[model samples]
Target: MGPDLWNANYDELLEIPLPKQVQLTGFADDVAATIVADSAEETELLVWSTIDTVEDWLEQHRLKLAKQKTEMVVLTRQKRFPKPFKVDIGETTLTSTRALRYLGVMIDDKLSFREHLESACIRASKTVSSLSRFLTNTIGPRTKKRRVLLEVVHSILLYGAEIWADILKQKTYRRKMAAVQRRGALRVTCAYRTVSEAPVLVIAGAAPIDLLAFERAKLYNAKMNGDNSNEARARLKKETLCEWQNRWTSGEAGRWTERLIPDISVWLSRKHGETDFYLNQLLTGHDQFNAYLFKMSLHPTPTCKYCPDKIDDAEHTFFECDRWKDYRSSTEEIIGARLSPRAW
Candidate 1:
């Protein structure tokens, strides 16, 4: 806390424990110690000892502990003891809390993600509202608006989704994500609140929350397990996708993530990356023509804006619209075959 004693710069002046004494980790202003135990009493002693070591180390370095700001939580499937039970470090009685934050994540004793999901949704919604002005009036290129939705709102919504993939289980949490996605789609398509999300998503070329979260989990798992060694990094480029998918299907993520994204490699490929439109629509399923999130009311309307007689949708806009008559005839003639626009 004072000068980092473990730091290489001060290693000569100050010495710390060898790695075997206790697993110690510190960064910035926070420090943590870990120990293994075989019983509840042993676990309590170990935790207190670990905390004491950290406190003593700080004291030696002339940094005092902030007892009032310090708190602890025991993480387990079963509450080891009642809330009244306490563990003491020095004169401070360390009480168990319902939740505590670690590395920016709010983790409760039960490990449920409801709190985290709610926090993320609130942050994302605020960001969307703050930056949504750019989405109005078509001031810049469509790509700019798309970037705001993806980089700002989407980034916050999907933060650490891979580590907490269990969020898929909570209906309320998943609904929060869906709600935010729909809001973004509304901005993207400039559709009225009563409009259906199906066409709006298609027009916006944006991926839905479920698929987006699963894809993020897949990528996160891959990065966490992969090694930094050059040999590991360079392994089998030709079959990397195949291997990754195979490995993913064997893990817990395989249970549902695989179904969400059938073609793992193609989803990860750069085939559509060159163009945001193609990327969102084709690979990410962020593009048009699906009714996955539409409701008859309180959702976006599904009527075609250009041709009021037909449903306004991706399929109609691309091929079946009266407006595309000339282009459609030329396309058929060029292909030298009569094709249904339903080929999509």
Candidate 2:
């Protein structure tokens, strides 16, 4: 039978009167029943009763419950249980687990979601490693690499974010998410590993992953409350972008990037722009520039190799250095504008 007819058949389980302290919910073929009682004996009895009813319904439909796949978890703040909780299903005995995977989300008894976050990060890191073969600091289409990172890796990491996004408020969890994004950002920007997170993200034109999770959560809540999806998403985007901008401005890192693209909204709104090696170098200040080399302790001094008086940073190399002055002038002439941060 089709899923609709199967669901209609399943609805009969809801009609069976559950105890006042018991509740049952179903999604497609999966059924989850919850029971509250003072003791393990009462809880097990209620659970067995519910399972019996469910098994009977399944048998009537010519289906058999998979005892091996069935899982149970008891959620409580108590440090210890007085006795082990168990329920018999046919010849198999089921026991409570500390954590279980439900609908692709790892849910622990305490609902801390630490296991889920760690699992997601591990999966995302694997994706990053796999992508590294084709996408690297010196190869691949920048935009395509970024698109894969966002659509694939990000989707994996943010699965069920609306439910567990609050965990991001914890610094430890936030760093785990950021580390995944930082690796992807490095690939996208073709930046050196020495480049900090903020500048790489700015150059990549990607929002902070934590803020994106918050935005996802907010959008989910808005849609749940019957708000217009499009309107709510737009509002959340503006708010999140504003917050990103605030962090970027206040942060000690990415000051050079901030100078180049002061207004993040403007940078993100561009219809046509790709970050290649040269552009990445200019925006991130992580190229062969003596200033960056010296900062990384790879160079003897930060002075320009061509013009010894001036420091060789992105700004000096682009605007003031005599080495690239002719190329800069020709480029400005072609664009009919001076090469300055305002021109960007």
Candidate 3:
């Protein structure tokens, strides 16, 4: 049947008065009824009576309730469990479940939403792994790969973020979501897996995943309050970037990267260039630089191989080394300014 027909059916269902203490809500053909009472027996009695009223209504409309697709769940926060009960409508018995998938979000007995977040992470991880098989650090189009990660994979992970985004405030949940983003960042930057999360994210020009989720939640709230969508999004983008910059600056990791990219906003605002393998290496300081290799225990010393006196890191290679002077001068001439650690 069409949506208008279903809407009319639901509108008619709303006119049928349910038992006392019971409330009924229908969306399309799915009906959810709730009863709040002091005891299980009273709740069950009210539920049965409510079901009888619903069944009678359905019979008049010649619609049979799908017994196999029906589910019931009891939500409680008590330390001791409530007594078990079966809800029988016609010949079907509905057993209470600890959790149920309503719409798309998973609702648990305790309403913690742990199950839904875990499932989202799993799904995002799988999508990243599958994409990784086809795309590589140097082989694929960097922009498209990043687009897929942000558009496809992120959509999967943040399906119902507006509702559950608050859970990401917990360190455990934040870390789980960050791990998935880390994988995508690795692909985007084409950097080594050894690169830490903050630097990889910066080099990849991706905001922190938790920050993105929080932005989504805030934007949703703003829209509900009658704010303009585009204006709200722009304002939230600035706020999110500020938070990301604060975290990056205050954190202990990615110190070298911080020097190269002091302002994340400038880095992200670049419209033309993509972060290719070489550029990612330069920004993250995770390339074959002697200093990084030495830190990784793959080289004997941190001295530059060409200069043999200065430490060879991203800063030295990009700004100090004489070997790349011509390339640096050419870039400086193109940009009409000299390159310095603080220039960006």
Candidate 4:
């Protein structure tokens, strides 16, 4: 084995890269050239960076070649080849909450598995986002707005669907998770503000909190090492309620934050009386109650020179003002006719 034999044999083949050369003809000639080359140095560096044995190179190269020759040929060129197969992100059946987390987004020159856990979470979150969008578009308008939160929650809960299908089927599983189930329900209920506390017309009719509230609560529960947890739950509860207030105040929902809160107050008045009050309230006078009252209030205007005062809270706008007598009269008439009936 010397350089002459190696050069004479491989000179024609080595002109092109191994991957490209491998396509025109098998790697047999390449292997032979590397074996009979001038020194082990050339063979090691240029030919066999993997190992010394011909058999080792052949075995590995065969698989690599098979992949290159397959559908991956075009993919390899596009840098999309050899995508590691994991759970499909676009598939609705995958439901893994663990995937909602991520370590780092950028990969270094030497890629390691430090980011594996986080990467999994990122992928899962992305999949949930995708599925959520799909479901939102498909489920129709009534429930479409909740697409983001529901998709994420379903993905997290049912992530191991194949494994958990039997567990989910058994009523025994729900019984074991009675604590979690209760907490989940509480998260949903508490994430919403009572009509009385914030009386906004939009929130009067038992408008549910966004699904993010429940998902965040569940995530919080998981972080607590399976001990029943309310830290995430509590944060989410306030976060969602606050979001409603924010949106309403910003005028996205066409109502004044303060004046509109009375409808919410009225709605909450019904719930303060019983356990599962949202349900119990309906059994009595809840259905007849008008949550729509708050939404109909005038949009808050900052430059109301006619408001007679600084134009602050609902009390200032409605009760103590003589400046806007005409506006007040109109309001009185509407209230007397519309809301007074509901109150009595």
Candidate 5:
């Protein structure tokens, strides 16, 4: 706009001397100020036009650079060497056939370079896609190795003929582990525990064991001979069991348990006539736990699914809407007659 405005009025505006005339009222200081203002405006107009031209040239330069970079490999191979012939320079002589051979090799290499570029681009795309998927999983240091191992184990279970996979799947193995030191055999399998903790190891005497397996076997032998009978081992075993118990118990110890129970009641009442009991069970879980910040009474006000206006709280969602009232009315009808808004 700056340069364009200048273009429309440049010569005409400069010839007027409006700023100079406005200041020069027969006083010396006024005449000086008028000249300064006029000069400043003319300088600004010129600067704007120069900047516009520079920007256009820069854009063209970038396009040229991009095209040159894209075709660099092929261009580089088409060499024009300056091999000037001279008397007594050396015993070596340049032959036409030798030069032609070099050119032929260069041409062949250029063709191969194009194919390699395409292959490189494909590999780069695959790498980028893999990285994107990995990033999207949001896996951190703690979860990354565990997730990878889990995936490997799952793949072996589904596709490989690994004996550990079979053992891991057995109900007997789990039952045995659960009963170890209690009653029956432990139902644990290699998949559930590291080889060191697993009590059972099946081996064909002739087969070579992996390094990890060998180390595990050595540890097991040591344990059997009471090499780890010290208090430290006992403490570690106790702590492991305590950790397991805490993980199990705390899962059901959510702070909002009391609030969820009543919401489940309301959800069951609302959904009872529309769906079967099993479906109601699922929806009740959804309504209770999916409550706004785990509080059922305050329904989460969604952002206007249609527009950008943010609904503040549950009451706004239920009653006020600059535009969503009509849709909300139809949704309200879906709830059973017995479950009024107050009950909800």
Candidate 6:
């Protein structure tokens, strides 16, 4: 089918009423729709009517609904109980599943992102293995290979991550994502998988996926806060960020007196590419004068090249180095940020 014609017809057909509860989430030959109800009976009624409406709409549009491919899956919290009945769609009964792959995300009945995380990890691993030859560490000439790998891997890893929260959630998913990132770093840098991936990531200018996700989530939260059109949305959006931050500060990172989250995501989005690159280096502590590497005896000298008196480490260079102290002071005054917990 031609793109324009198919899209026009599908768009027209999808606007049909599928009951008040069921919502049309996307428009296409393939759509992911949802319906929420209080009870099984109400849900069933809505589902039945939705199917009927879809069928009638298809008929009116002179297009046939593919009964064989059509299937329905209901997500519920009842783990031990079997579905009392099945949803009938023509001759085929729609099958039920513990997990549903919607828009490339695997959402299980529990609303946990575990399945999606696992799926993304698997896809990322396969990409790493399949494209090993492209390693100027994952990309080469003009960043073509790197761009392709990122477009595929990061897209899978961070899909819908804007909705990520910590409450009633597990840290295992973050660990898993970090593990995948470490593996990619090792592969690209040709380091032993067991070795620390920090240096490799820094030298390669690669940002960890978990950090990237965290930054993106913060950006999404900021955007929601700035949106003023709808009251309900604003409240929910604010609540989402507040809940996540509260859980993070109180539960997992309670020891941290100052907020660990920098407004760098917003900065990255608005700033130049070079600035973004530098910020990542700063956050990861993996810039040109990497002190930790010198401690490992990877570099010839640990002393600051600009100021021979002071050790040129991340902390010193970025904060206390004699050479940059003036610059750092001016920067702090301008941004109104001290960049340290004890600096105040």
User: Best-fitting candidate, measured by TM-score?
Assistant: 2
lDDT-superior candidate, 1 or 4 = 1
Give the alpha carbon lDDT tens digit for every residue of 1-344 in model 1.
Answer: 45664465334222455334356555556554555555568767777766666667777778777877776666555455566447777677878787776667777767886677888888888877865766663343475446456557777877778778667756777777878777877665554554444334433446556656766665555567885544443443434445445544565522322343444455444244223334334222223443212333433666665676676544555557787788889988997876453232
Cα lDDT of model 2 by residue, 133-176, tens digit: 88877677766556656567788889999999999999999999
lDDT of 3 by residue, 241-314 (tens): 99999999999998988987888988777776777777878777887999989999999999997899899988
Q: Is candidate 2 or candidate 5 better by TM-score?
A: 2
Top candidate, metric lDDT? 2
Instruction: Point out where model 1 deviates above 4 Å.
Output: 1-22, 34-40, 137-143, 196-199, 224-344
Q: Order the candidates by TM-score, highest first.
A: 2, 3, 1, 6, 4, 5
Model 2 has an lDDT value of 0.85
Cα RMSD to the true fold for all candidates: 7.9, 2.0, 2.4, 19.5, 33.9, 9.2
Better of 4 and 6 by lDDT: 6
* Model 3: residues with Cα > 4 Å off, grouped in runs: 83-85, 333-336
TM-score of each: 0.61, 0.92, 0.90, 0.24, 0.15, 0.59
- Model 6's lDDT to the true fold? 0.59
User: Candidate 5, residues 1-344: lDDT per residue as tens digits?
Assistant: 86666445333322333432233222211111121223433533443343344335436545111211111111123244222211121233322111111211222222322232223234433443443343332232222233343333222212211112233234543333222211100011111111121111110001111222223334455567778645545554444444433432344432222222223223323532322222322222222222343344544553444344753433344446456566766766775433223443
Error of 5 at 284 (Å): 12
lDDT of each: 0.58, 0.85, 0.83, 0.35, 0.30, 0.59
Q: Better model by TM-score, 1 or 2?
A: 2
Better by TM-score, candidate 5 or 3: 3
lDDT of 3 at 55: 78
lDDT of 6 by residue, 1-344 (tens): 59888887688655775667778765457766688877776776787787788778878878776767665666677654356446776677776666777767777766776777888788887876665555543234333245445456667677778765341135677777766666665544444343454443432345555556665576667667785546545565455444444443454321221222322233224433322334434434554664646866788887887788777755677767777778888988997988563442
Which scores higher on lDDT, 1 or 5? 1
Clashing pairs in 3: none
Top-down lDDT ranking:
2, 3, 6, 1, 4, 5
> On a 0 to 100 scale, what is the lDDT of residue 322 in model 2?
91
